[model samples]
Target: MAQHETSGFRSFIFSRSGMVLLGFLAVAGYFLWEEHAAHILGYLPLLLILGLCVGMHFFMHGSHGGDHGSHRDEPREDDR
Candidate 1:
């Protein structure tokens, strides 16, 4: 059996620019919480639900529109 290679945290999770973007988001989130906490908190549930639905759609629709190569490259004996 072949062993699976795992990537390090920075390389796998986020690139250098991604780290900066995350930091910016953290700062923005803090400002939002400080300035508009009630409004942002009220919208949080809707944003979470929207993200979940979009993620589900992408995950359910696999590679090449859910084909997953179930159909053979060549004809089989079962085909008439």
Candidate 2:
């Protein structure tokens, strides 16, 4: 006999029961979305603004390497 080692989560996700569970979740999610779509759409603008703010916070600050004054002390090439 041969034995195989696999994590429980990996094994379950590949099993027949896992397929059924995934299908059930898909159906449930579709119905949930259909039911609450109107409410979600009503807040779409607010959600978009919030997402933009969050994205800007991360991306804008990422270039500065978290040091706001690093470039202030350096002399510009045109000044030399």
Q: Against the unseen true structure, what C-alpha lDDT does each candidate score? A: 0.82, 0.93
What's the C-alpha lDDT at position 35 in model 2? Answer: 100
Cα lDDT of model 2 by residue, 1-80, tens digit: 88989999988988999989999999999999999999999999999999999999998878867566978899999999
**78, model 1: CA deviation in Å?**
22
RMSD per model, one decimal: 14.1, 6.9
Give the clashing pairs for model 1: none
- Candidate 2 regions exceeding 4 Å error are 1-4, 50-80
In candidate 1, what are the lDDT values of residues 1-80, reduced to their tens digit?
99876677656457877788889999998998799988889999999999999998888765656455767676788885
Stretches of candidate 1 off by over 4 Å are 1-32, 63-80
In model 2, what lDDT does residue 43 have? 99
Clashing pairs in 2: none
Instruction: Return model 2's CA RMSD, one decimal.
Output: 6.9
CA displacement after TM-score superposition, residue 30 of candidate 2 (Å): 0.6
Give per-residue lDDT, candidate 1, residue 11: 68
